[model samples]
Target chain A: MRVGLVGAGVMGRVHAAGWAAAGAELVAVFSRDEDRARELAGQYGARVVGSYADLLREVDVVDICVPTHLHHDMALEAFSQRRHVVCEKPIALTEAEGREMIAAAERAGVRFFVAMVLRFFPQYRLARELVAQGRIGQVGVIRLKRVSYTPNKPGDNWYLDHARSGGMIVDLMVHDFDFACWLAGDVTRVYARAAGDRYALATLRFANGAMALVEGGWANPPGVFRTAIDVAGTKGVIEWSSDATATIRTFLRQPEGAAGEVGLPLSPLAEDPYTTQIKHAYEAIRTGAEFAVTPEDALRALRVALAAKESARTGRSVTLQGG
Target chain B: MTLRIGIMSAAHVHADGYAELLKQIPDVDFIGFSDEDAQRGQAFAGAHGVRWFRRHEDLLAQQPHGVIVCSENRGHMELVQMAAAAGAHVLCEKPIEVSRERAEAMRDACAARGVKFMTAFPMRFDPSVREVCARVRAGELGQILAVNGINHSENPSGHRAWFADPHLAGGGAVMDHTVHLADLLRWFFQAEVETVYAEVGNPFAQGTLSVDTAGLIQVTLSNGVFASIDCSWSRPAGYPRWGHLQMEIIGERGTLVLDAFAQALTVYAKGGARWPEWVQWGSDPNRAMIEHFLHCIRTGEEPEVTWRDGFEAMRVALAAYESSDQGTVVRLSP
Candidate 1:
């Protein structure tokens, strides 16, 4: 598969590495800055395309790695050219844009995949599998936190702009929103509050009667990334944290006053999540296998994030339409 | 001169720790104790080689220089009133009286009698926390922008039954765990909390427990510093220790990370104990708090953790419960 990458930023560099490990032909690279594109292209021994139009025509797959607000336009353009598309989350800044992009992909008969990389993470995958197998029965409550340092750039940092990047909730926390939905199903209501641009907390009640408290923050020191999740079920509970030596832990509901959580070790995956996601997407495109996250799945995650932002803005609980 | 201090009740989980601190301090007399649960109180007093007063008032009537009120939540006010009436400086265990009115009354009674009223916010006395606060005050971290903290603990119901009873404890983890960090943050910013929003769950016991055992609380301070606290009793039984306090403070110039109980030696032995014990090697904050309480009384000075500080911290905690109950952000008055 020939892949042309867009927006040679941090994520662009990450995806370029992913594509190389995925064994895809990195046909070309495009960035608004010619120097960035040239740098990435040189590193990967790929050609640098001068324009988005030229990059679209150069490869079979278009990977959009630009700022979130540009996702709709780039994905739309990719679909218009009949190229298979992989867009990073959140699919777009608005639901309307998300719908239009999905519709465009459907009309063009091209595969549209969103890089919700959490689904590719080994621990999260195992957690979902365990829940599916009812290792922990009758899910009741979940708590997820993804905290990191603020992304500070010298100039024109799109992430600091809420309109462009949707701030922390849509940009950073959308991962947890997607993961929570995947674990507990569609959200029925959301109550949230934000502390400036850095911190946000949201409580989501799922249609299945499970509740999830999702917390995200961008106030820590630079390069500090911490993620933790706790899922409580009828028969037991499952927990995992990035800071722990153990990968995952589970506690069965024993008789009263018994020990909780038998620590379980995870078999480390060979490939990083980025590489795995990239490889999975490429394989799905070639073999017609199911992708880890569909455009609609990404859209549902976006809706929950938007609902959280709305709740934070209005100081009231926001109800969602069932997907 | 030795400052005589009496323990009011042995009901609080920290009662034994306080007694130990009193014993360790050379200048403090570890006087007798009293509790409504006479057998339990007598057992504790006997274990510590102190007299067991049949009536709680009898212990107060000893006219000790200071009294450590370690009764259950609802019993704090009466103990404080009795200790204050006996002209002893009162060192009340936190969430001061569980209600703002009761807490204020305790403070007023102490003030009218010219007695020092100290809230036992031992976290404020933690050496690591004190160092961080000192740096912040010195402008070493610049203007504090945000604070995040966690006070995680084992299910207190495993430690004491009263912890699961809302009537006796006022609230659950939100009440028991919130005040320590709340007091610390207030001290750090020298400001009151202006607004509070909280999310709580009973994930540990799946609501089979009477009170909530988990909480995530956000507070916006009058000093423009935003803070969040995870006051949860979700620690596992086999966890190394009962709990630890952790905080991350982000400032304009620098950031500070504080683990209040991080200086510990973990003992891991096969077939030795149910859990690997994390023996704390750090300075004992409880001892510092007791010494400070005695020093305030000896010098006729107000306590660093004054009754008003306790009231404000308790008010913020109570507001957190209300916010969780109402499912909205609650604003506090100045």
Candidate 2:
């Protein structure tokens, strides 16, 4: 399959490698920054296109790796061209925009895939499998945490802007929000609180009478990232933490005149989740098998995240319709 | 004179550990224990080689200097009143009683008689917790930002059936586990909880029990530090230990993570063990707490963990239930 990549940012590079690992031909790269586009395209032996229109005409699939605010327009343009679209998460800035993209894909009879990659992470996959198999019986309470330093430095980054990135709750915690629904069911209501954009906690009540506590933070020191999940059910509980599962540690000596540094802990696996997620999308599209995460799942996750954001703003609980 | 100590009841599971500690304390005269359940009381008395009074009054008649109230949640007030009237200082089990009114009455009963009332919050005496508390108070972490706490245990219904009885225990995991973290947060920040929001569930014992077995509680303190407590009876029957208490405190300058019960020797038995057992070799907080109580009695000083601490913590737990029931944040009255 010929694939076109958009936005040569961090996610763009990650998706480029993912498509390569999934055995897809990367035909073109498009970004407003010509240098970044050419650099990423050169790594994959692909050409850099001047505009989105040219990139769309050259490939059957368009992979969008831009900021969340740009996802709606780019994916809509791809769907209009009858190309399958892969977009980074938070599907769009708002639920209405997300729905419009989903409706556009339906009208064009093309596939739309959102990268909710937590489902492809081995630990979360196994946890969901266990729950689906009734190994833990009926789901009860789920506690999920993701904490890290800010995605980019303080200034000159769109990620630090709530308008562009939707802050920490929508941009980061939406993964857990999606996973919670996948493991349990739909969220009935969300009550959330935040300490600026650095830290936030959300409580969700599920339709099955289950509950989830989802916490997200961009407050850790640099080079620090941690995630944890604990699911309790009638029969048992499943718990996993990134800190506890580390298989490697390095304490390399710094240069003579350099300041001390913090090293990220490594938990290496055979295949990374990004590649696994992209490969799954590729195979499902090829074999007519269902994608693990559908557009509606992404939309539902965005809706819950938006509700949590609203709840945090107003200091009140937000209830979803038909939850 | 050696401090005289009696146990009011053996209904709580912690009573076993407390009774063992009492026997080990060198300066205390371990009088005996009372229990309303004749069979359970006799079994405990026989196992420990101590006397069992069938009635609380019979035990109080011994005129002990202090008593540990370890009755069911609802029975705490009556036991505390009886012990206080007997002119004995009281170390009451947590959630002092079920409601705010009853807890206040218990405290008043003890205060009116000039006897001390100490809450059973052994985590206050835990060495690791003490170190973290000291460092936090010393401003080593700068201004505290947030805290995440977990206090998990196997369902107590397996050993003490009343824990699942709503009327007897007041609530389930929210009542049982939330108070420790609540008390600890209040102690750490030196602030009262301003609001509480909790999502409680009964998935663990849905068919067999009527009470909730899991709860995720969010608390905002008066100091503007928000905390999350994943307090539940979530450990399975095959889990290695009773449970654990862990806290991650985030601060502006630094962060501290404390695994209060991580000091243990993992033993993987060869005889078809279902799970590897964690045999703790660390200092016993129970013993330290009892020693502290005895010291307070001897010195005529206030207990570090006072009735107010327990009362405030119980208020948070009660608010957790209210928040869960009403599906909103429950603001605590200042």
Candidate 3:
């Protein structure tokens, strides 16, 4: 598969590295930074395109790692060129924008995806596997939390400004919000609250009478970071982490007697989300297999994050706008 | 050798169950219970066929080797102080007290008096919940992704206004229902709550527990599993005295969902018009807890419920209240 990468940012470099290692053809890399773009492109054995339009000329997959504000317009251009678009987080700031991009991609008959990287995380993949196997009888509830130091670099970091980044709510939380809906069911209603525009809390009631709570923040003092999640059900509980140093644990309550612990640790892979996400994308492009993170899934997540922001601003719970 | 135990404060609802269980244990002596209210003292004593006294001091005068402080939440600190002063070991119920400061006092008093102090957290003894913890530690569930706990009951405030008042209950359903779930989650995963996001309501709390009938608790555990819970005392009555609890611990190889107390086979009388077993089907949770307490006391080992366990549970509950106050998430110090 020939890949053209846009936006010579950290994320773009990540994708370039992924394509190089996977034997996928990296046809070109595009950026406003001609020197940096060519330098990074050469590392992947690909040429640098001076303009975004030049890269779209012949690539099969044009990954858009540009700023959120630019996603809507750039994605349309790539879609019209008949190239699959892999956009970065926030997908476009709002579900409406995501829809526009999705509609364009559909009209062009090209695949589209939002990089919700958890779907590619090995521990998360294993969670879906356990659910598939009925290891925990019918998941009844899910609770997720993602926390890290609040970025002080307001203008440069991009996550500090609420307008540009949507703060933690959209940029950080949309990932899991989409995940909860993907696993549980359609989220019907949401009650949320925010503090200092940094930390956010939202409770979602799924159509299945199940509930999910999401806590997203970069407001804590500097540290490595902490991500924790738990799902409760009829049989037992499944708990896991994003940190590679930790292993997953299932608290099973059946099959012969009393409650007990079952340690399940996945084999560590050097290739994390960056490599795996693209692998899934290429896999999807070839076989039409789902990229794990679909446009609809990404849109649902964006809706949840946007709703939380709206709810926080209004001090009222918001309803999930169904598409 | 028989372990002579003194019962302090018969005001707590679960006190009678502990009295009955102690009598059944051949190794335990069913010593008299003390109640500030003599009516409660006699009622508890007569109902369980145990002895009683009007004052906790008089009860401690018996010089029993151990004491069970089953009193009002406010009285926990005082009763624990008395028991420790008398050089008697102590076992108290959840919350330890209404505040962390008071709970710490009780712990410090117990330690200074060189007495065994345990808080009765019976959910730890349930076979189903423990199984989940076992499998998690054994690495069968793989690297965890998330954890959740559900605890619901008829409102805690309706029956007792003190359960709703901040000075008495400390918080609403957030305090009443949170400890058990927090302790259970912490024990099962061996994780601490790092941050909390909560939405508290006062719906069913009518007279006592307040209108905050339901609450959603969002938290992150130290082990890096994002966790949350829907805890409340807002279920419809006649449905069941107890609501329910379910948990999902998501992992690498598989997920573990634990539905503790999912089923209870109730016997129906022929041509029954009402639940005839209201008299017969009393609480078994209390019985299970007391039995485990005796098991630990006799074996000189830690019971499933320890005082430190109660402290951590209280911390989680307090954090939830803090989250509730601001209507946002609050992170706890490591």
- Top candidate (TM-score): 2
Candidate 2 regions with alpha-carbon error over 4 angstroms: A153-155, A253-266, B270-274
A-chain TM-score per prediction?
0.92, 0.95, 0.87
- Report every candidate's CA lDDT: 0.83, 0.89, 0.71
* Share of true Cα-Cα contacts across chains kept by each model: 0.15, 0.53, 0.05
Residue by residue across B1-334, what tens digits does model 2's lDDT show?
5988999999999999998889988978999999989889988998888889999999999899999999999989999999999999999999788899999999899989999999999999999999999999999878888898889888988989999899999999999999999999999889999999888888788778999898989999999998989888888887888888999888776457899989999889876434688889999998889988998889999999999999999999999999989988999999
DockQ of each: 0.21, 0.63, 0.05
Q: Model 1 over residues A1-323: C-alpha lDDT tens digits?
A: 89999988877888999999888999899998789899999999999988899998889999999889999999998899899999888899999999999999999999999999889888899899999998877676677878776776545788889889998899888999999999989998787767666677777877876767787877655545677887766555677877674455555555632321111112356777888889999999989898878988899999999999998888677878764
Model 1 segments beyond 4 Å from truth?
A35-59, A80-82, A107-109, A123-157, A180-270, A307-323, B270-274
Q: lDDT by residue for model 3 over B200-319, one digit each (tens)?
A: 655443344333556788676787666667786545443333466777565544345576775465655565433422222324566677666666666777666678889888888888
Q: Lowest lDDT 10-mer window, candidate 2 chain B? A: B270-279
Per-residue lDDT of A55-171 in model 2, one digit per residue for the tens? 999999999998899999999889989999999998998999999999999999888899998888889999999999999898888889887766653224787788888988998
Error at A244, model 2, angstroms? 1.3
Model 3 lDDT tens row, A136-225: 665555778775555543235665666677677887788778778866778766766565444566788676655677766654334325
What is the Cα-based lDDT of residue A244 in candidate 3? 35
Error of 3 at B297 (Å): 27
Q: How many clashing pairs in candidate 1?
A: 0
Instruction: Rank candidates, TM-score, best first.
Output: 2, 1, 3
Candidate 2 lDDT at A191 equals 88
In model 1, state the lDDT of residue B193: 89
